[model samples]
Each structure stands twice: as structure tokens, then as C-alpha cells.
Target: MSQLLDVIVAEDNIVQSAYLARLIENLGYRALTVEDGKAALDLVQDSGAQILISDYQMPYLNGVELTQAIRDLDLDHYVHVILITGMDEDEIRSNALAAGADDFLPKGHNPTALKARLRAATRLVQHSKQLAEQHRILKEANDRINDDLNAAANAQRQLLPDIHTEVLGTQIASAFVPSAVVSGDMFGCFPLTDTLIGFYAVDVSGHGIHASLLSVAIGHLITPDFFARVVLKGQEQPAPANLARDLNARFSRSENDDYFTMFCGVLNSQTGRLDFCQAAYPSPVYIGPHGNAQTVGDGGFPIGMFPDLTYENDHMTFDKGGLLVLCSDAAHEAENTQNQAFGSERLEKVIKTSHRIETDGIPEKIVEALSVWRDRIPLEDDLTVVAFRRT
Candidate 1:
């Protein structure tokens, strides 16, 4: 032991107490003599002693009663109680143990037995202290990790466009629900020119911190300046295929396995022309002016996988009073308790029913439908929906 262990001895006989105290000191421990069980408990409580040796008969409290009282105290350290008794009956031993006595010793000056018991008690107390210290450190580390995750989640939310926004006469509405504190999903709608509106919905390969980091990076990179410089070809309108190819080239690396699905588009508000590229993302639903729903986009390769893959551009029309919805796979692939998916048919039906409602309330209806399908179970993946309506 690095330091001396303090042991409390409670006995009414002054001679016996002195004898026990001398034996304790001789065994490389500090002895604290008390005349009664009450005094012994006070000494242990005040000194935070780890060992208590008490005679069965005392002035105020018996050894068994004292052990029970010590066990009830909310002290930070454990006190190993050893009852000294003259009787060797099984009933007495059972009663002492039942009252929280850790060990029992015959009422005599047997230094050998006392020394053995003290060594065992010291080992147990040390183990308990080590465990408490380790628990404190782990709790602090967990709290710090939670705080960082919350901060990152908040910053990612700030990158999202408002729930209801207008860009160049186009009414845009969006909804995002993350399964965890951080998400693998991101989307944005911004104007590229006075007559051109650019938008994108991205889902990183996996969920959690790594996926969220990539999504945030993509959100920061897909600005108007980026579209004018890289996505557009010298005074020409921005090409969706060029944006997909550039992202694939920038993110693909041999050292790491990271890829994402993207739906990138540039809509010409004046001509109602929508040029888009779908990189393995879910096909978007296009609702016509007469409320007829149809799907768009020919599925292409996922970005950031192969180094020299080519993506092609597809086109559609966003005419007056028509609605276009882009959703991540989570919205349709969500499962019920029976393990059945909320497939594309159900998703299209929900959008069709909400067509008469304002564009701002459409995404909420879709989210509510998914929530009811899951029966209140937590989402397994991130869910995101972006809708566009031409007035």
C-alpha cells in the first residue's frame, strides 16, 4: 500500500481497545479507537475510513446495528465491517452477515486472522475507488461527444433553405427529417440567373458523421458562382451533366470508399424547360396541370465511384400550375412493422392528393403519411423532400 489504511476499533473495554489498537498499528495500519458503535460510525463518516472492527456488545449500538447504519450512509467510500463476537454459533454469524457485516472475528487478540482480513478489505476498497474514477471519466467523455454532435447538426440545418421559399417566380417547398442527430441528406434551391433556377438533392452513401460532413461540403460547393464557373460552358446555360461529372471527379479517390446519389437540375422559368441529371437517385414525380402524375429521369451511375464515368442530361417541362417533387429514397423505402415498404405507388398517390393544396403544405402531407405508415416507430434513414410549383 502506498499510504497507511485507517481502521476503526469500537469496544467498551478500555484495555481490549488499547490492545487491538496496538495490534492494528503493528500491522502497518493507523488505529482509531472508539468506546461505542455510535462513536465508531461517526469516526468512519468523518474520516472516510475503509475498515471498521467493532465488538458485538457496546455502549450505544451493537456491531450488527452499526454495520447496518454504516451501509445506509451515503458516503463516497465503502467501509468493510468486521464484527467481533464471543459466540461462534451459526445464528450469530448469519445475523451479522445479514446486517451488512463483511466478515466476523472471534473475540480475542488474534493478530494473524486480523491481518489477513485487513489485506482483503484493502484490495476491495481500492478496486471500488478505481471503478468510480473510471466511470466519471467515461461520463464526461460521452457528454462532450453529444455536445459536438448537436452543434454539428445545428450548423447543417442552417445550410437548408427555408421551408417555404421563392426563387425567380418559382414556389419551392422542402422538408428534411434526420433519423439521428446528424444526417446524410442535404438539398438546396437557388437562382442561377434572372430566368434560370438551380436546385439539387443529395444523399451520401451512409448515415452519421462521415455522411453529414460530405453533404455539408456539397451544400457549400453548389453555389451560383460554382454553377457559372464549372457547370456552365462560356455564356451558355448551366448543364446538369457537367455538374454531376465535376462532382464525381472531385470526390472519387482510391484511398477511401465514399459515394452519393444526386438529382441536379437547372429550370428555365421563361421557357418552362427543366434540364436535369439523375445519378442513381430516386426518379422524381411530375404532376401535370390536369393533376396526372408521372415519373421522370433515367437512372445513372452513382457519383464518386469510378474515375471516368459519363452522365447524360435529361429534360422535362415545368408548365404553369404543374408540380415536381424530388424525394430521397428514405421517403418511399421506409418500412412498417410488417417489413413492407411505403413504395413509389403510395408516394405518388400522396403527392397527387396534395396537388390542390398550396405548395408549402405538400411536403408536410408527405411526411405525415410516412409517419403514419411507420406507426410511430423511429425512421431507419434520413428523409428529405423538395417540391417545386410554377405559378
Candidate 2:
């Protein structure tokens, strides 16, 4: 149900105030009559009145003074002021208007003009109420969306591996930073056998909810059980290329162009034999114990894009005291206030010196270096890094 329209009549003349009040009540609005402008203002403030009909001459406060005072009040709704006067002077009308009078009524009190002004005031007040209601609804909806995004982000973080751990004699450390509340990057490291360990990094095609959904799905799909069934061959070493091939076949769709990049590696703990497949992911930096750094991997097709894509397996030796650093594209593409990219050269340089630092701290060191290069600005994309050191 709608609220009643309140019209406050402020006139010192008892006969005139009674007439105006009767007319207002006839128009189906509640009219409150007051003997002076001061009393009218009190009524307006108390009742949240949106229409004020005031006389030009009154005790304590006149019509113009009352209009200005009403305007000064920090009321939520707008008050439509109609100033009534007997004089025909232009200065009087101008003063009333300058003092915030929205309309004017002759002292003779014509019912037709009064009715028209009240109708207009009713329409305006109703419109304002509608707009306020709409703003409230939008705010509630936005709050709900933010809550859902935060919950999903927490779930995504749970899918990631620990920050630092040891698996199959290799010291492993990782870091992940999302550009938004949710991320499109995911990674994991797990022991495939008593002597073999597997690690992989994945970055979906874009940012926000769509990409984050796919990244989370990939995280669940690439578990150790899935690797055992699909990637590991009987009595032979696991082939990362086969995993890449399977992912490509599973996610590729003709309806949409969504896809992701991945870098998968299987390392033999005793021999330090590293077998890897890079699917359009950033080439990893291989740092020798003496700080010599070189990039690994030849570019291959991004997964979930093309069908029948052949992925090649690459091999390298993970010598003792050697450090292998893998990162998402955000590592090198992060830009400073000057818009200069941190670049692959800087990335290699940072990792090259990691041999001097503890293996568990290398991932954080890389992130800190990138933050400095970007001048502490938020990253434009998700940043992820996984580091492995042969002890």
C-alpha cells in the first residue's frame, strides 16, 4: 500500500489556513495546519512532509525564511514549497524563488492552481521513492555476488599444494597470487611412485569466473589417481606428453575458443632424470648450482584448442644442487608504473641467484622481486611459480 501525501499549511490568518486545509483534504491528501512558519517547519521535520504551503507574512519566520530553513534540513525526501502572497511585486516573487520556493500561489487561493501543483508534487515524490527502492535492490544483489566469489576463491586455494614440502628427495616450493578475488591459475606436485615425483602448472585462457571455473575443474581432474591411470605406463616412466594430449582431447570444444596452457614434468628421484612437456606455457628457467641459468622447453600447442595436436616430450638432467623454476606468464609480463614489462631476462636473473637462498624461500623471493619491478601495483594477471631443488 502507498503512503498518504502530507501537505503542511503555514499561515498566520486563521480563516485562510482553514480554507487551504479543507481544499487539501478534498484533494485526498492529509493537510496539517499551523499558525506560523516555525510551527510548520516542526511539522515538516516530524512528519517527513513533501509538500509545504506557506504564507508570505507570518510571526517568527516568514514563508521565504521557512523555505530556506526547510531546505537546510538534512531530510531524506525533497520538500516542495508553495509560497502564498497578496502582493504583485516582482521582488517578492523573486525573493521567494531564491529562498527555494518551488511554486507560488496567490493570496486569493485559486483551487485549480493549488490542485495542479499538489498533483505534480505527488508524482515527483513517488518517483524518488521508486528510485531509492531500486538502489537498495541493486546493492543487495552486488553484495550476494561478492560473497559467492569469495567462497569460490577459498575453495580454489584449497586445491593448491602446500607452500613448501619435500617429495622423493626433491625440495619443492610454490607461490600463487590472483589478480582478482578468484584466479585462473592452478598447480600441484605429488609423488607418482616411490622413486618418481610429478609436478605441473596450468593457466586458463582468461581471468574471472569463467576461467576460474575451468582451472578448478582441471585441478580436480589432474590428481594422482588420474595420472596413474592415464599418464603412467606399466613398469615404465610416466609420460607428461600423454597427460597433455589427454587434456587437449578432453577440453577442446568447437562452440567456444576457451583453452589453457600447461607445463608438466616427471622426475626420477635417484637418477635426477626429468621428462617434461610444455604446452604453450612459459619456458622454465634451469639454474645450475653455480648460478648458470638457461630456459627449458620448445613451444607446443595450447590445450583445449585444437584436436589431434601432437605433443613432444623433452628430457633434461636435474643435477644435485640444481634449481628448476617454473612460472606463469604473469611473472614476466607484470608491468611497472612506467608500463615496462619485468621480462624474461629479469625473471632468469632472479632465479639464477636462488641457489644461494633456501629452496623453500625461492618462490617468495621471485614474487617479491616481481612486486618491486611492478612498483607494488596489483598484477594484471594471476601469478604462479613452482620451484624444485635436488638436495
Candidate 3:
């Protein structure tokens, strides 16, 4: 950035050295002279000089040797070396270049040629320093972005419910595996009153920061507190179907193009009765005291698709000791090494075989099964699972 300010000259002959140093000073640069190659290296090392001009055939250490040694040192600046030799320019050209000289000069006190070479070296130094500064600025920006993403992921964790817990005689367990720093899939159930519990499992359409942000916004929008605030003034409580319709209306008014699929439900804590609506989500598997697991509910329109989409509610009895399983598409869509999908049939098979495990182990078993199928962790999409058993 600043002009090539400091230069060091190594010449064993005092007469030629003084003449050359005078010429450099006339070019508006500070120049210092050393009588040998060893002194040149030391001066350049300590002074942080960016330009070097040296004479060949010096005693103890030659000019070529000095050039190589200076280049090898790990310094904060880049050095440009010029080799001045008594031999013909063609004769010493190969060896001088091989030893790392950037340009070569013929031996003598020619003021015009000296001025031209030093001028070129000044431009080279300016360009190199500019590039180094740009690299430093870009690295700082990347580090700041990574720090912000990590902070967002930590805040998103608060939207999730406790992992393995039981309340109102119901055991609930969940597992969340995000492929990126944040996740687009969110699921949790909250109590609406002493006699009722509402739950939802949702997946936004796209992946990454925008999708993750919307999922968190949607989580708060549907919570019992927010839902209670938006419902009709006279209505003390709302059914699951009416709640789904309200979400459709609110999201339709939003300017975002992204949409989502969800399963919204309510349970009578005392009677094991579930009233739920499935909006373009997976048909949750019902595991009761039966011999085989049965899938429940049919698909309907997804949320935010239509302003007047009337949602349908289905009823099922989550009898005591019965379990319900819900998951995002990432589970079945995961691909094995052979490129085959671990589809719905495989997921159903795992539920039937492992449903008898302790209440807290159900979600863990599903995650393990998925890991084995994929042969590793970190699936390509956000993976989420929620399982609850009525006791």
C-alpha cells in the first residue's frame, strides 16, 4: 500500500556499493548497504525490507545463496530479489533465477536501468500487499456468520419440549437430528387444561435458515397461549379441527411462499380419547395391545395451501397401554448405500417389532433403526420423531 520504502544492498566492493546506494536514495526510497551476503540476510530479516538488490561473487556467501536463504525465512512480508552479476546477463541468468531472484541486473552503475528495475519491484510489492489485505477481510466475515448461526441453533432448542418425560399418565419421548446448524422440523405437545392436551408435528417445505425461522414462528403461533389469544371471543376452548383452520387462515395472509404439513390433535387426559386432523402428513402408526401395528388417519390439504380449506377431524381411542408414533419425511426418505429408500414398510416393521420396549425407549429405537439403515449419522434432511403412550 505504501511505496516500496526500504531496500537492502549486498555488495562486497565498497566503491560500487556506495554508488548504487546513492542512486536508490535519489529515487525517493531509503537504502542501506552491507559488505557481505550474511549481513544482507540479517538486515533484511530484522528490518522487514520488501526489496533486495545484491551483487554476485561475494566472499563467504554468494549473492545467489543469500537470495535463496532470505526467501526461505517465514516473514510477514514478501521480498523481491534482484541479482547483479559481473558476468554476461545470459551466462548468470539460469543460476540466478534457480536460486529465486525475481529479476536480474547487469553489473555496473547504470542509473537508468537501476531506476526502471526498482520501479517494477515497487508495483509488485503494492499488488501483493493489496491481495493479502482482501484475504484477511473475507476470513473475518465468514467467522462472524458461523457465530451467528450457532447462536440461532441454541435459541431454537428452547422451542422443543423435554425429551423423555411423563405427564397426565402419558409417556412422551422425542428425538431431533438436524442436518445443518438449525432444523426445519419441529414437534411438541402442550397441555391446554387439566383435562386436555394438544400436540402437533410439522415440517416446513424448504431447508436452511429461512425454513428454520418459520418453524419457530409457527411453533409459537400454535401454542396453547397463542391459540387461546386468537380464537373467537366467546369460545373458551377450540377443537383441534377449528385450530387447524385458524392456522390455515393466518398463514395464508403471510407473505412467505413457504408452506408446511402437520398433524394436529387433542387428547382427553382421563379417557384416552384422541381427536385429531392430518394435513398432508404421514399417517401415524397406532401401536396398541394388538398383535400388529395399524396406521391411522388419511391425508388432506396441507396448511396455508388454501384460504377456505375445510379440515376434517378423525377420532381414535388411545386406550391404556397404546402408543402413537409420528415422524417427518426424513425417516422413510433416508437412502442406504445401495440407493434404496428405507420406506414406509420398513418403518412399520420396526414399530411392530420394537413396540414392546419400555415407554422411554421407543423414540430411541426408531433413531437407531434409521442409523443402521443409513450406515451413519446426519441424514441429508432434518429428522424428527415423537412418540407417546397413554398409560
Candidate 4:
């Protein structure tokens, strides 16, 4: 940003060199003079001169040869080289530019004309430095943003359950897809007992890092013996439905007015009982041994909506070889540009139609149904599907 011009003059003719150096000094700059092209090159290297003015014809090294050498050294400072030529030959002009001279000055040109060219070169140096500075700043900002996004993604991944574990005598398989650099969808697994597993899939309001952060908050509440105390505590004979109502009260105190829809359940492997609570989330589907499918439980208000709202629980009996499928609303509500939701009805038909109910097949069939419905449109929100089957 400083307006200081340090120039180097290289002319074999001693008198002409002194005159040019004097002219540069009069323009409020520091001028350096060398008698030959070699000395000019050496002085510019050590002094970091901003501009170089040299005579075309010199002994040992010509002005064009010297310009090429300057470029080969890869000097950091912007050296605006002006080649002074006595001849008006087109060959000399072309060769000067090819050798890396920025401008050409004829010998007959007056001091006034030569001064104008130097002024132009000074402006170019200032502008070039400014552009280089801007490029560095932009790259630094982009790197910081990428680093922050990667950290958020790592935290989001930790919220997911271990798919390789056997819990509650069921094999659990899951798939989570976040629409952006960060997502708001959450899923967790906690062992209620050696033979029982507690799991929940939640969708926080909004998207990106904000939604992902909220999922972490909900994970904090899914404690051990969560069902007996949070769901069935104090009720000498508490129904699964009654337990869900109690949890609704405990989670309703979030500061934000936005709601988080969740599907929570305790699966008892010994008795094949799936005690479930759904609040404004899609119901989990049960695929029978014969492939007959039915949706379980009635849904209540989403958590974090009302501080005093009540929730109801629903119960379902699953036989051996039955599969339970649960997903967020994003799975059903995903649409193409046409604005038509994939809908639960179509989702149900897909499950019942597919005779192959393998562990991986559950999520695959649902995604296939959505892909067809959305016409291959990109997912607009977080999409999650969890499938559990009795071994």
C-alpha cells in the first residue's frame, strides 16, 4: 500500500545512464545505476528493485538477454522492465516482448514521454500486489469454514448406534443420510436389559449444524432404565401408553418453540413385545413372517412443542421372524419439484409388495420407492431409516 518506487537503470553509455537516473530521482523515487546489463541484473536481484530501465545494445549481455535472465531467477518483487532501443525495427520489438520486457522505449523519445511510461508501470505494480493479497485472504477464510464443517460432521456421526451389535435378541440395521454438510436427524440405541433394547429416531426442527446440535441434546435424556422410570415410574401398573405421556412432560421444557418429532420404543426380546411411543413422527411398520405388514401405535404431539402437552403410548406384539421399520418424516415427505410427497400409503405398498425382507432390503425398498416417487430429485431434508428384526 506504500507509494515508494525504487528503480534500476542499466545503460552501457555512461552519460545517458546518469541522465535517466537523474530523471527518476526527480520523480520522487530512489534510483540505482549500473554500467552494463550484468551489473543491472545483479543489482536488481539483491536490491529488490520495482522497475528496471535498460539500453537495448550493451556489451557481454544485451537488454533482451538480461530480461530473460531476470525471469529465470524468479524474483519476488514486480520488476517492470523497459527496453530502450535506437532502431525502429519490428524484429527488435517482438524479441523484446518475447524475452519478457514489459514495455519498449525508443531512443528519440523525450524525457516527458519516458516519464509517462514509468508512471504507468508504477500503477500496475500497486494493482498487482493488491490482487495477490485478496486471493490469500479468501483462501484462508474457505479453509476455516471447511474445518468447522468437518468437526460438526464428526459430532453428528457419533450420535449413531453401532450397527454390528446384538441387542434385545434382535439384529438392528440402519442407514442415515444428511442432506447438507451437517444434519438435524438423530438415532440412538441403549440396552434396557440383556434381553431388551431401547431405541429412538428423532428429527429436530430446521437443518444443518443447528439441527445436528439439537439431536445431541435429546441424546442426553435417553438414560439407562429410562423406560421403567421415565415411562413407567410411580405407576404400580403403568401401561406402555401411559409411560409415553410422562416422557412428553419431561421433554417439553426446551427453550425453542420448535418441536422435535421422535419414535421411541422398548423392545422385549423374551416376550416379543414392542412398547412404542410416537410423537408427531411416522409410525414404525411391522412386517409379519408371512410378509403381511401393519403400522404400529398412535402418534402424539412432537417433543419440545408444548411444556404441558401430554403424549400417549401404544403397544404391539411381534412374533419371531417379524421386522420393525421406523423412519423420519423426511422419508415420506420427500418430493420432486412436482411438490407431491412420497406419502405413507405408497411407502406401505412398497414394503408389502417386496417379498424379500432381508436386513439390508428394508432400507433399500423404502429408498427405491422414494427414488421413483421423487423422480431422482435430490433429498431436501435429512433421511433416516432403522430396521430391526427378531432373530
**TM-score for all predictions?**
0.82, 0.82, 0.78, 0.69
lDDT of 4 by residue, 1-391 (tens): 3556788888888888888888888887778888888998889888888788888888777899999989888875568999888656678878889988898788964788788888888888787778778877998998998899888787768767764456766878787888887778888776765766677788988877778777766665565565556655674333444444555576666576656788887777888877777778888778898889898776678777776777666678888888788878888888866787888887777766753567766776777678777887768888888888788
lDDT at position 197, candidate 4: 69
Candidate closer to the true structure by lDDT (higher is better), 1 or 4 = 1
> Candidate 4: misplaced stretches above 4 Å?
1-135, 235-255, 337-339, 353-355, 364-378
Per-residue CA lDDT of model 3 for 1-391, tens digit only, reads 3454898988989998888999999998889899999999999988888899999878777888887888788677789999897656565767778878898777776889889999999989888888889888998998998899999888888888998877677888998888888988888787777877778888887778888988888877776776444432354434566767888888877776878888878787898888888888888898886645888888878888668898887878888888888988888898999989999999988887767888688788999999998887568888888888888
lDDT of each: 0.89, 0.89, 0.83, 0.77
The residue-by-residue lDDT of candidate 2 on 1-391, one tens digit each, is: 2657888999999998899999999989999899998999999999888889999889999888999999899687788898887667678889888988898887788899889988888888788888878988998999999999999999999999888989989999999999999999999989988988988899998887888999999999999878766667763766899999999889985559889999998999999999999999999999887878889997999999988899988889989999999999999898888888899998998888776899989999999999888888889899999999998
In angstroms, what RMSD does candidate 4 have relative to the true structure?
Answer: 6.1
Model 1, C-alpha of 256: deviation from truth (Å): 2.2
**Residue 181 of model 4: what lDDT?**
77
Residues 65-129 of candidate 1: C-alpha lDDT, one tens digit per residue: 88888988967777889888776567877888998899888877798998888888888889988
